[model samples]
Target chain A: GAGVSQTPSNKVTEKGKYVELRCDPISGHTALYWYRQSLGQGPEFLIYFQGTGAADDSGLPNDRFFAVRPEGSVSTLKIQRTERGDSAVYLCASSDGQRETQYFGPGTRLLVL
Target chain B: AQSVTQLDSHVSVSEGTPVLLRCNYSSSYSPSLFWYVQHPNKGLQLLLKYTSAATLVKGINGFEAEFKKSETSFHLTKPSAHMSDAAEYFCVVSLRSNDYKLSFGAGTTVTVRA
Candidate 1:
């Protein structure tokens, strides 16, 4: 079975720029989640989607961070006005349903200079 | 609020020796517990999970975990540590609801010495 996959394994962008990280969930998965892992720290929750709507976005840091899963199979995490502090690994995961075990993607390493 | 604590930040064990990684969780309700391992420069991988059905859960790579409600602990153990077991291990807790949120611990780095 194919696992969750994230595109642009590594991304480098200047501050104040916009970048989009893409995630392709496993086939038949209805739940997707996004998280960020800083250096020497565990992953922190960001946002989650069930079907085509975001079930929870409370973990999102601010308005500059946004995510969308339009068709439910793929998702895109958009960051506006990126900051140097945003330099971290952005990870995506997908599950068959809510409350189920999540399968994670390799992640996209974002670097803001 | 739900939270997880990995008592040890790092654990060093020799190959062929027993390995133990302690984790304690706090939750208002009966929570779902999981063990995930991440190798260097790799994504998180699910090792095992406890969803109230069983107390002793077995996972891949000869790894296992025991969920103790009396102590609010879920400790991962391996009978014999292998050199490949060197990685960062995380303990996560999620409320048993439709919410897709997970509380992660600081993680314990296992260093298996040969």
Candidate 2:
């Protein structure tokens, strides 16, 4: 009965550092997604996984943003050489499948200084 | 290529008054539409969704939306506003051809007054 969950609800990092945000999808969910929401803006898709493999990662802004879902139940979004411009909320969501309604987690607020 | 637009940046209504939030979407093919609500410090919650089965879709907490293909609109409506309804609302669209990736609007902030 648990919903999607994200760890460390808030993360403050310095520029040029590395960070990893974790997401634990709902039990039995096969599809997972990651998005970023800038202040005063809607969330934008970053990547999606339909099991252990990433089905799409075109939304990743650059090579610095990468994600992995090795076991299909949990996913980690990794960022390298973070910049102040990367300060935003990183959201995670999961669904039964691609066509199903996606449920969201509370999100990790990343503040890069 | 697909996008969603929420017409109003903010809407304020007295409690018990009718509420309306307008949204429009553009897509190259048939799309799945949804409305999501996010209260302060809370996760996004699905209010309702329309996947092309019915033009009028009913959602939780006395809310509903009608999908109008002719006008490219999917406006949310509630008969009466409540204090608990004050929050941020987003209009989202996803395309089957594009692997159901959601494209969200900027969002509408609603304020309810007693």
Candidate 3:
């Protein structure tokens, strides 16, 4: 079975620039989630989608972070006015809306210079 | 409020030796627990999960974990460590009964030596 996949495995940008990270969930998965992992730390939840709508985005650090999962199946995480603190690995995960277990993607490592 | 804690930040064991990674969780209600592994640059992989069904859960690559409610602990163990087991392991907890949000521990780094 195909697993979750993320695009632009690595991204480099300057401060104040915008970046978009994409995620492709497994076939038939209705639950999707995005998380950020900083150096020497564990992953922190960013946002989650049940179908086409975000069910939770409370974990977003600020208003600069936004994510959308339009039409379901795929999602994009957008970061506006990126700062050096935004540098980290953006991970995506998907589930079948049951069991509470999630399969993760390789993640996109973003570096804000 | 719910949180997860990995007792050890790092553990080193010789190949073919036993391995132990301790985890303790705090939750207001019964929680779903999971163990995930990340090997170097690889993505996170599910090792096992305990969703109130069983106290002892078995997972891939001969890994297992025991859920102890009395201790609020879910410790992962392996009979024999493999070089492939050298990776970062995370213990995650889902506090809500039906929520997609997960809270992860600081993670334990395992190093396998031959």
Please, what is the TM-score per model? 0.96, 0.98, 0.97
Ranking by DockQ: 2, 1, 3
C-alpha lDDT of candidate 1 relative to the true structure: 0.94
Q: Native contacts retained per candidate?
A: 0.77, 0.79, 0.72
Worst 10 residues of 2 chain B by lDDT: B93-102
Q: Number of the top candidate by DockQ?
A: 2
Candidate number achieving the greatest lDDT relative to the actual structure: 2
How many angstroms is residue B48 displaced in model 1 relative to the true structure, after the best TM-score fit? 0.6
| Model 3 deviation from native, Cα RMSD in Å | 1.1
Candidate 2 per-residue lDDT, tens place, B1-114, comes to: 899999999999999999999999999999989999999988899999998898999999999999999999999999999999999999999997875589999999999999
Q: Score candidate 2 by TM-score against the native.
A: 0.98
User: lDDT (0-100) at residue A6 of candidate 2?
Assistant: 97
Error at B13, model 1, angstroms: 1.0
Per-residue lDDT tens digits for candidate 1, residues A1-113, read 98899999999999999999999999999999999998877899999999999989999999999999999899999999999999999999999998778999999999999
User: What are the Cα lDDT values of the candidates?
Assistant: 0.94, 0.95, 0.93
Which window of 10 residues has the lowest lDDT sum in candidate 1 chain A? A35-44
Error of 3 at B42 (Å): 1.5
> For all candidates listed, what's the TM-score of chain B alone?
0.97, 0.98, 0.97
In model 3, where do residues sit more than 4 Å from their true spots? none
